[model samples]
Target: MSDHHIVFIPAAPHYLPTEQQVSSAKAALWQWIPEAEAIEAAVTEYVQFHDCGSNFEYVRCHVCGQELTIPQWHLLMEQDYDLERGFGLTPQTLPCCGNVASVNQLDYSFMQGFSRFSLTAINPRTGAVSAQQTELLQRQLDHPLLVIYCHV
Candidate 1:
């Protein structure tokens, strides 16, 4: 069975909203997509990549626009991943342009990102979020958010 998820993450990988902020955001999301199966919010100990699952395509350098192949991306991720601390999210030189960029800074084809905190809705029936709703959620969380749709 396939499943869909609507994920919202703060733009800053290290940002974690306060409990009140999270509750406000959750309330806003529930009001916006009341039919959703479930809403889950989490604040993690370290920055973690929130991928778009099967919706993922490719990642490219934000500065140079050079595509980073899956293998190259994997190598970079492996180098940065720490068993105890999670991803370092540090800058690495791109093989194509020699420009430095972090994995979190890459342009994901499917709107994926890295964050220490995330809010996700399971099967929100409603498709993409509207611009107005996005803005409202941002205000509730007091942080700019990245909306990601994941299919699995």
Candidate 2:
């Protein structure tokens, strides 16, 4: 996979749609272009990393050869947080991996909030570190203000 930056996004759970919206949402995202590339599990970890912080962008699972994408975001709006307070703080709407509702527009904000993280490559195939992949991911992580990473 080509290097895609791990940029922060502006979105909360509410911004997403419902179950009926999953197919449409994914389809819409596919059209937006692959912002980043990673497997489903990596996506899950990236989501979790946002809550605390992760060591890598895509974690290798030793058994699976899939590369997970790391999700790093700031100015996180909690489930019950007031929306108006963060009304104009987003840079854009990103694909929700189940936690979010839907992505609509792109908003770019200079302010930072909630959590910040870095996405690294994990080998899932051997739970080993891919130095090559890590370096590629590190570059993407450096661009904190990017709207999307080139989906490899």
Q: What's the TM-score of every candidate structure?
A: 0.97, 0.23
CA RMSD (A), model 2: 16.6
lDDT of 1 by residue, 50-104 (tens): 9899999898988888788899999889888999999999888887788887888
> Which regions of candidate 2 are displaced past 4 Å?
5-10, 13-17, 34-152
Q: How would you encode candidate 2's per-residue C-alpha lDDT over 1-152 as one tens digit per residue?
A: 43333333323312322333333433433333344243221122122222212222433212233322333332233332344443333333333332332112212222122222222222222222234543433343332221223222
RMSD in Å for all candidates: 0.8, 16.6
Among the numbered candidates, top lDDT falls to 1
- Name the lDDT of candidate 1: 0.91
